[model samples]
Target: MAFGFTKIKSSPIAVDFGSDSIKVLQIVPTNPPQLIAAASVPIPDHARTDTISRMAFVSEALKNLLDTQPFKGKRAILSIPAFQTIVQHMAIPGNAQDNIEFEIGLNLQQRLNINPNRMIIRHFPCINVVKNGSTQQEIICIAAMKDIIMQYLELAAKCKLDVVGMHSEPVCMLKAFEQLQCPQDTSTAQCYIDIGSATTKVVIAHGSEMVFTKAIHAAGEQFNRQLSVKKKVAYCEARQARIAHAHGIDLEASLNNVLAQSQGGSSHVNDISAQAVIPMAKNEKTLGRREGDKDSIEQETIECLIDEVQMCLRHYHSLFPDKQVQKLIFLGGESNHTNVCQQIAQGVRIAAQLGDPFARLARIGLKNPPIGVDLDQPQPGWAVPMGLCMSEANI
Candidate 1:
């Protein structure tokens, strides 16, 4: 029998696979870890419509991306979609890591309602755990379904990238945050939000450990769609207009015309408010009718968003009612959507004690030019990719 199996140090490359785009990042720690290389690849809607086609395009893009970077490492760390994986901390025996993985698989399989054998499990000894309604020393076992896990590895294989260790999106994101802003004081729970085109993820962390995470069903892309359809302009144009609107610019006047042109019961485009369109923003009809039906549309959007946020907070509260979330941070393109943060802050204020948590990185559109755009800092939507890369290596 082979004894003392050789331990292979996992040199995982982090590739962020998203609905609209994909990006790869690599970094090595040795006298201030420097960024090896970064690349952004876009996927068209047609290609993404089918799984097989999408995979093909991604495989091709990955090969090209790797060629450009010429990274020398084989082990790649990848970010799994938060919703697809189950993240929970259970008190398992502080025994061998392998044994704990086996037993934890049994418990989580029952808890997660999945076949026990189908899970890809990993755990690290936690300094403590909750027992008999009290906290005690134990291990933190993170389990993700194997089917989903293998898909990622397969994708890496297809791209000719090495897959070392799999990472939960939230935890990886927390590490990215620490990299961006060296954990201030290291004593408070910091909330991080990542808003993609369709899904938004909120993660709470202390140092590199993620204590809570949640995702919302809305993002900047949807808002752009609302603007694009109504305005008849391209999505890029609408996106620009929407960002301007987020910063409190009154695009209401011309935006009305865009609504007028698009206002047809035939399009099946639901226009909640004449306000969604500004007559001044578009010379032609760019927005739908919001003239008199303000109440229904306004209330519906705000309430839905509020309900979603509260649901996430309630979940975390159930775990530790007394644990106060210090700062609520926001991320993603939509985080810059005007008063979105204020709206979320107000919602949390009513239900729980949400400290002054801001998103990990908030993007402010159009800074001093010549500088081009300062997306490197928090004021821009720079944290997402950085977090995706920085998080892979963090403990």
Candidate 2:
């Protein structure tokens, strides 16, 4: 094929290998990024724990998705799942500033008892700290084993895809909300709480700079287990029930009944009854629990999650006493439950809203949008993949 003066550019495919599912996305690089194609495949229950099985499942899913979707180019960026990476805050001698990377590597080697050369390390310098009157530099360090990186690369190669960059979930998540950063007001801190399948990630940032991050053990899977135990049902059944509750099928049915009454010209039916399905204000102190067997179980599970998030916020406030998180932006698969999010916001005493990565996207003209994904509604689970699209190649 001959002859173009201008080089054609396409964003690298963003692959988010989540614990519960594998999400693949690509966007046209433009002023307001345009959605090109997206697809998601759930990880089978049998493959969830075993590494070999999981990898094999991912390989097959990725191959099918790429071959079927309208994704352009083969280059892709991957997000290392939160559970697979080591993220920590360390204090090093101020004198080590000149060779921070080397010092961090040595420190990690000593702490983890692993070969520094066998790990890929990255760090972000934070505010200095004084311990016993001696000044020290504080930094957030992220590391992943070389073997795990190679495994991902090999998977991509097998699928005939080129792996261009690798990023941690926290980094990719922050990148997804770049448009929300307020350059003029750098002091206003914001918190992002991503409730994923295995773990929850809490990221605190002041404007565009990330200051702190933590991964909580409590998340969606825990919720499912709690529901399973409470209901005396199989884990898979509980998971299905949880999904149905999140989608508000019961509420939808009630709304449909109200609409039917209004269409029959009943004077008793009012607009307020129809709008009652919307979640209450963030400041509400309690959720109006439904009266039934499922009510107590759902409430207890949400309370447990809120407790973990509250603890994380307290820890962050202790470290950065001067900076307070002004807002909470909830993302990830579990955030689809509006009632759960509202209760957590109430428990944390912070104004919060569900994060929508596609909110700022230009007129979406997706050719093959993933099943069950509605562009008109906020898709919080797509945050990591969308952020990857906005990311630059680390290589």
Candidate 3:
């Protein structure tokens, strides 16, 4: 008999097919997970509006990334973009527990006028309620088209990736913060706001159980349009300027001055302190053009988003009258803008902080980190991909 050691199981690659970009991540599941490989590619300007073109672009990008990166194993888990899935809270007959799927299918067919057999449906039981003098269970139903799931699977196959599991973005986002849950304190509710390029997702959790989720259409693309119109610049130019401003490049001179003072042992230098010292430029030239315009255009755009977020909170409050969200943790690509996050926090009137999904992870193989990822700063944008990494595989 030949004796051999069993091979240790490696984590499946976590892929997030975001509207703006496609992010791939793999981690070694150590005590504190360690980053093994990470890569991202932005969707082209021409492909953003076309579904087929976007999928083709993503397929080629994934193939190239996997070929170059040191990703282990061909097995992968991916997130279904929130926009592609239908999430709704519905009340069904109390006796439907044994046939919940059938009831949900019938309800969906009646309300949405779509064939439920063509969709992959899942539900989470919320609470029981008396409706029409009959007890009914309120459940959050998530449905994604079977064709869409097949498309994602086909995309993965094109990249030679074995799709092991798939999940919705909201679920993946919550998984990314699993380590932060306080089992001892179940009364305090928390809200996670993921402001992505296409949409902003609001997820509320009481203790470790998620209770509410909403997706807002107001997000980064709106900010870009606002900036483009206000600055009289091309859409692409406005996008670059918006990114530069978010990274504090527009206030370079002011930040340098603060840095000098900090080095002189004046005070601690952080994002908040730097913002305080550097009066946000009203209008300044950076990256060879005027990039600072947060006072008007940016403020208006963010205010629109804040209003939507407030509405989501109000809806959650109406559902759980006794529970109130005590904290707000901002995530997603657009959350990189501290000014925007600060405004939203102030507008929502909640104690808030930028969520760093990678905070507890030990970064490795980061000599050349992926694009849009700066390990030194809080990466609220990588929340979905990171969360996907922490999730369990189907097989």
Candidate 4:
């Protein structure tokens, strides 16, 4: 009952709603986290835009999850898309708790400039403050449209699931880290960057305490867009090109071929359809660039990714400039790159590393069930659901 609802007596599972898919992972804490059951299903591209349709799809998948998996739990924890919401900690003058509430109300009204009536505004006390020769408590504020939140609850209801609590994407992911018993201390800093098809989220924390969170508009699909235009290939074909590039299966010729197709020149004619082989039309696609150069396109894309990482580093440094980042985690499928972590390390002057929270789920007593769905290993895209479950279960 964390979201102003009746408290659930039993621990619920975790349900993560992603842009392209929905994942549910149930963790029953043992010595390490024990995974009771886990299931993942992709939302069709066409159905993703409709909230109602997405809900129906989620419900259908959850039913299948329950029928096929051994996870037996009724309570559920939920996570919201961090990118769609604004989350930041702002400090103001210190005052008594009641007066502070009033002051915070005014401050949010002024700073957020959003209608409180239309938005779901929740504030968590951050750190106690000393300002204007008085004691003031700082709060981390997260605001999202009420409509979006209601839609989720409504969907959950339709699915016959009871949601126990709601958590932010970063928090749930971090909870998954904790379930993993990631080396976290006051001196230890970790940054989790989830790069998806449409956007990338950067969240940094010292140990388990969150320090910074930000979102950039560039993601994996953007990379595919470039390949499509450069190779003049269909979306699926361009996607194949990108995956091949990421896996190191192809090289300059691979890219050169894509570019050749874009220019309407030569055709490889490798038993592929004319329409499928046709080079894509080019559109002005912008990305995070380390240095501005149009010709060095590959480098440009890599640098743009680094630039976003640099921004995350800057935010982390502003809070703890003296400390160094001990670990860097890439969470989304697009983050699968050989030199991406190293490149980020070079750009930010810190050791960058990839992290897998899914592996840690077992350590926290969650069961990793095989439900016949393909799980993209390497990346723990399942972190959110595991996190929500952790939040609901309190471990």
TM-score ranking from best candidate downward: 2, 3, 4, 1
Which tens-of-lDDT digit does each residue in 228-316 have in candidate 3? 77656556556655665566655443334444553584533234212211212221221112335356667777778889889888978
Query: What is the per-residue lDDT of model 2 for residues 8-99, given as tens digits with 9 covering 90 to 100?
Result: 38789999989999999888767678888878888888898999999999999999888888888889999888878888778888888898
TM-score of each: 0.63, 0.85, 0.84, 0.74
lDDT of 1: 0.55
Candidate 2 backbone collisions, by pair: none
Query: Candidate 1 regions off by >4 Å?
Result: 1-13, 27-33, 69-75, 87-112, 122-143, 179-186, 218-302, 350-384, 391-395
lDDT tens readout by residue for model 1, 1-395 = 76996643323556777666676655443224444555666566657558778778878887887766645576676777554556565666434444665667776767767676777666654355465776543444556778877777888887776665566656656665464454545455556656666577766666666666656676656666766676577665565555545444445533543345445423122322223112122322322223342442233454666677777667656555666676665555465442455455556763212111113323233222212122232232434445555544432
Candidate number that wins on lDDT, 3 or 4: 3
Q: Which residue runs does candidate 3 get wrong by more than 4 Å?
A: 1-8, 183-185, 251-295, 364-368
Best by TM-score: 2
lDDT of 1 at 244: 49
CA RMSD of each candidate after superposition: 10.7, 6.5, 7.5, 9.6
lDDT of 4 by residue, 1-395 (tens): 34775533324767777776777776556445666677777666556567677777777887778667766756777777764576756675654565655565577678877666676666665456566678766566666787888877777777677777778786777776674444546577778877766667777776777766766777766777776677676755566455445544344555666667767868562421111011111111211222333454445566787887887677567656677777667676565443444455566665444555555444334355456333334444566776676675321
For residue 72, give model 3's deviation from the true position in Å: 0.5
lDDT of 4 at 382: 65
The lDDT, on a scale of 0 to 1, for candidate 3 is 0.78
